[model samples]
Target: NRAVMIGGTTGILGEWGPESEENRYEGAMTARQALAKSKNGATVRIGMTVGVDPVIQLCHAAGIRSPLRPFPATFLGSSEITLAELALAYTIFPNGGWRPNAPHILDRIEEKDGTVVWQSPEDRARQTVIKPETAYEVHSCLVDALESGTGRAARAKFGLKKFPAAGKTGTAYDFTDALFAGYDSSITCAVWAGFDKPQKIYSGAFGSEIALPIWVAVMNAANERYPAKEIAEPKGLQKVEICTRSGLLATDKCYDTVKSSSGESVHKRTTYVELATAAQMPTEPCNVHGEVRTRLVRDLPASGFPRASLAVDPKQVSPITAQGPVLLAENDPYNAVNSTLKPKPPPEKEKPETPSPKSSEETNLPDPTKPVLKAEAVEPDSTKPAPKAEAVETPATKPVLKAERVEPDSTKPVMRAEAVTPTPQKSPKQIRRAEPVHPSDQIPEEDILRPTPPPPSNPDD
Candidate 1:
């Protein structure tokens, strides 16, 4: 259950390529939990950890004859393979690490007279592809997937819970294809639904929606003939209580509690038991909780207060009573002695005393000590009448002068004024109009405009 970052782009080529189907950001979960949840980013991380070449080789050994590319994208089913091949590959899990032979149509052929004219070859011996412990672990995870994860509809919605079976649900990119491949001790089955030309079937068409039902129906029919049985736990495996948060041996502090929106406790429990091989069993107690507490203790004294001064009555601070349920973040304490103590609640505010309402007369009265001045009356002289205010006429009050309309003489030709286009001014300053020449000045226009020539030859004069 160690934290793994999920739903981010990862690949050698570009920023946009290879993203998880569901964009989860981060979570603390086991590989089995990751598998059950069908987390693409977690799966890609596993593939990178395991290396792409080994994964392809493992697939080949498990009966996937299809060619797989050596790339991280292949970890999320970028390579194409038939449903039959996939179902055959799943056989390795229930078969205790042994890869089964290719499925055949007939076990043997016989003549009509009951004398065998021809017969099928002897069954090929299964190949041991992986350790039994490894297979059982994967088988357990697949069972979890069927019971609670992507294939949960097979049990909850389709009523297949009674049967002991395990499977995975698959939905292709853009929901173009939906598939379900599963197996029991009795038989293996695979189902697929999609268009012949490879177009989207419909929006939100997941394998659990489209193909798991078919797989469930087929498995139910097969169960009648084969009588499905629980897959046996193989040897050399141990069960240990593991912290779901840290994936280490669980300690008392490794418990978790869930609360309702109203802050009521909903569920509370410590770690869950999980199967692990002798080599994989956790040796260390969960440090995540311990570290969190230690950090809180180390930082408390530095917060400008002595540890002794911060002590509180444990009876009043019981997490179960005061807080309902204690989450990891809420489990703040310096040591085991103080573990029951919770953070102090904010102080209650004191209510202000309401002022008495004042009477209207008292509120309206002026202060008696302050001087009150009154307006003085002035006597007017007998001979002088009060000066009258002059009437000031504004534009709106002023009378407008109207020009009289004169009738034009019809006998006289009326000259029409031609419309003139004004030339655009280059400069912003207004041009001054030339002054009209006086009629009394009879000088020639050229002589007036020309500069008077200096009297010819002052020397000759």
Candidate 2:
């Protein structure tokens, strides 16, 4: 269920992003399966693995004359080509890796007087582009495409299943163009549907819906004209059963089972045989089921004791018996506590004594240890008689002045201005807002002007 990367980049490539049409994750499909299903992500992965130059060279060898960019997207038909070039390219597969010369408009020209005026050149040598086995492998994949993949409509809907035909269906971006390229033993053909100026043809306009029907119609006539022959499997290619989940050699454990309502078990095989070149044969077995560890058993002489008697019956045992004293006699640290064979009884808790009732007079008496507070003196009656002022003699000696620390009154509010140190207020930090810059603006002038590296070339081509 992991997402596949396109062009080995982390970000999306917009509408050009390669993905499976079903929008579902299909784990570990073989190359043939990828080709048959037209898996864009898988195709790009294979192309990237093989490198851009080699892919371009292979296209050239297949007779594609159009200029192809050395970009990874080219694997998914990002580069455009003419129908003629595509048709010619498909010839190498059915022609056993031999690319035939360009077709002539006329075989020969004859005059009314029965004299041959001109004729097309003969004895043109066909180039060997790929090995026969490689071509056959690709042909088998194309055959799978017709039988079960994108081109299956040709067989299911168009009634083109009688002959052994191999083909592929291609739909351009946004359904701008649709094409079906295929071949049988005798003839190769390609059908394309699109306007000169590319534009959306219609909604859901796949090649199978638009172009395959026409190709099938043409092939129906060709099938009648030429006898159907089986595509021969070339030497050095063999069919090997491989695990669909791991793409490795199938093992006994590489299958699953399902149960039906009737209590019947159905074993679904996860392996299928597919054509692979000798060098491409699987070297390792399927690891998908390797982690299942089986329990091992061994036989030995029976014991003299009865097996039934060895079993412990928890139901018959009492809770006390099941959970006996935690500490044994020998392990007990307190001998006094374990004097009796039975568990010791818990000790009784002490009861608090109640105080005797006191007399009401004693209850009202103030505590002698506590300090007594004196009542304030009442002001003398203002209307009472005033006493004559008496002259008193001044004290013989001056009273010594004593400095005494006085406690602050509890009723009055105390000023703690010095106790509370002023808290320093922190200034808000300034965040410099940087203006958004375009990605192109960040690139250096030299880098922007630098020319793209030339695409690699094949010496053999």
Candidate 3:
């Protein structure tokens, strides 16, 4: 059976036998240990892996005439079988893969005068059903069970240590049946203890507690006359060392360290169980142990103390997260965190000290003390002949500046402004009475050199 406490799965089938603290899972062990201890989970896992069909085919060849249901639970002996059929199947292991004849008591029958009428066969022939190596391996496992496993009760409880024997114990799911089936070199026996109504025996009524004592008593009395002996080792079989925990080959490091008397460290070796055949042994060493070593760092902390080293399994290290701080490239666009935490500086605003040449505020500002110029509309004489207008005559649009005006052409009537020299000797009253010219009435370039007109005569005079 495979080790169920390790990688084997029970699905939903929980504990099947008795409930006790001693029946709790104690982790993985060798197949021999699992078979000897009658571990239901381990046997179920093995049956599932090996398939129920193969086990059924093997049982049929070994003379087990019972019918088995097509289910994984059949690995735990879910099918029912009579004691004679079970005992007949077990005889194959002792007889080297051959079934023995059925039990018979009568030798012959005489008809009224001591005359032989019907006689049984002098020698009962056996049939070769399975390979000798297969039977030998199974027998070896049962022997180991009796030595230091659940079947140890044979010697402990029944005082049956004189015979060299091998056996297996069986129990139903709800304590309905308890059985003990075993054999020595000469004889084989099977015992069963249970209620006729198929009810629970007790809380912890196991096969060892209920049936093994009776089987031991029968074997003790039977072996005294038969004289028990060991079976010959079958050919095509070899022994190999295997690790108990992993069921693999033992490695050099599969031992614990202990201090010797001279303070030197010594390795206390682990137990190595041998399998029955070379085909049953493992090829790989146990992988549960790992190596540990110290590594050097390039930089130390500012505290001037060595950094504490932590041991990590090499298989579990990730390429992205197992390293120290990472240095990002300058053009890396991906950000690991929010950008709001590290706000960028606002763009610098550019302002020049000198003003531009085309600024209107610099060129249009006028001096307050300068005399203002004014534009006047000139009236042409109605008697004189006027000149023809030029083809490229200037447009009469209003000027935008306060000191400028549109000069008139000779043919078209227009308003013109004439320049006047500032009066050097003007009375205070005339200066106070002078009016300022608006920007809309400024003088044009063509009338800048014209003579100023005389003051208008008041009509009141």
Among the numbered candidates, top lDDT falls to 2
* Cα misplacement distance, residue 185 of candidate 1 (Å): 0.2
Return whichever of 1 and 2 wins on lDDT: 2
Relative to the unseen true structure, what is the C-alpha lDDT of residue 102 in candidate 3, on a scale of 0 to 100? 57
* Position 199, candidate 1: lDDT: 91
Off by over 4 Å in 3: 1-21, 101-123, 257-268, 276-461
433-458 in candidate 1: lDDT tens per residue?
Answer: 99868566354343322223546666
Model 2, span 427-451: residue lDDT tens: 4465788985668525434333222
lDDT of 3 by residue, 1-461 (tens): 21112221123123443122245455666566678777677777788899989999877776777898879868877888788888888988888899855545577999999999999877576777788888887888899877777788789867886778998888776567888899999988999899878887975577888889999989989987998888998867777666564555677777767899999999777656574566765676765533432332456679987678669874454222212232232322333111212234698997764633545753465544687788877565766656554445346784343333344477865657776664343223323567756576354343333223556698665
Name the candidate, 2 or 3, with the larger TM-score value.
Answer: 2
TM-score of candidate 3 relative to the true fold: 0.54
Candidate 3 whole-model C-alpha lDDT, 0 to 1: 0.68
Error of 3 at 255 (Å): 1.1
- lDDT order of candidates, top first: 2, 1, 3
